[model samples]
Target: LPAEKMAYLRSLQQKNKRVGMAGDGVNDAPALSQADVSFAMSTGTDVAIETADVTLLHGDISKISYCLSAAKITMNVIRQNLFWAFFYNIIAIPLAAGVFYPIWHISLNPMIAGIAMSLSSVTVVTNSLRLRMLIK
Candidate 1:
């Protein structure tokens, strides 16, 4: 039931999928554990920390934004990587299969493929690094 409740709450949020739980007592432990990510007070019960993925060193609730920001950055990087991987395969597979031979007879060069692979890495890293400049 707790997990279902958490899932319902997650579905209610827009765009972001992060959930932060604040608890100082045992009753909140189950809900805290059900979140995708969680934070607990340093002075909170041990069960709280055991259930949370992160424990706030100073018990400051404000640090929740930092966690959300990190999650957003990670999601963005994942999207970028997925896009590059999909794009590479979509083009490379057709080329490798000789889909263009009927017209230009052009094929993808191994050198170009290597460049594209390297650029994919660069693009994902650069996009991830941009999170550092984002205001929390």
Candidate 2:
């Protein structure tokens, strides 16, 4: 297929949709460069490989699904960790600073606060580790 035709097709698709191009030839480089996500085979021309967003090291096209799935899972794990971290800080900081002492006479002991902070960090790490199980 002509490179110009490929470029024309990409232009039409890109106006309202994301385009993913997979190519292995130098002639495919331009379209690959323009694609939202481009995949190049490891055995392809150097220009195609360099122009693409991702290289399939073993030239197995099926791995693209795995890559996309893993990316989504990783993003979710990051959001979960951030939420836990922020939630811990929001509740923990004010108590440690004695903000509730006047209202309810509640104060966090410094040693206990330290332990709680450490535990919060551990929780985030453990939550991240859960991804290993999910991804496989």
- In candidate 1, stretches whose alpha carbon ends up further than 4 angstroms from where it belongs are 1-20, 35-37
Worst 10 residues of 1 by lDDT: 12-21
Q: Give the per-residue lDDT digits (tens) of candidate 1, residues 1-136.
A: 5666566656754446656567655666777876666778888889887888888877888887877777777787778778887987888767866788788988877788678768877887787777777635
Q: How far in Å is the alpha carbon of 74 misplaced in model 1?
A: 3.2
lDDT, residue 119, candidate 2: 97
**How do the predictions measure up, each by TM-score?**
0.68, 0.79
Model 2: residues with Cα > 4 Å off, grouped in runs = 1-16
Report the Cα lDDT for residue 5, model 1. 56
Whole-model lDDT for model 1 versus the true structure? 0.75
Which numbered prediction scores highest in TM-score against the true structure? 2
lDDT of 2 at 64: 89
Give model 1's TM-score versus the native structure.
0.68
* Best model number under lDDT: 2
Deviation in Å, model 1, residue 12 alpha carbon:
9.2
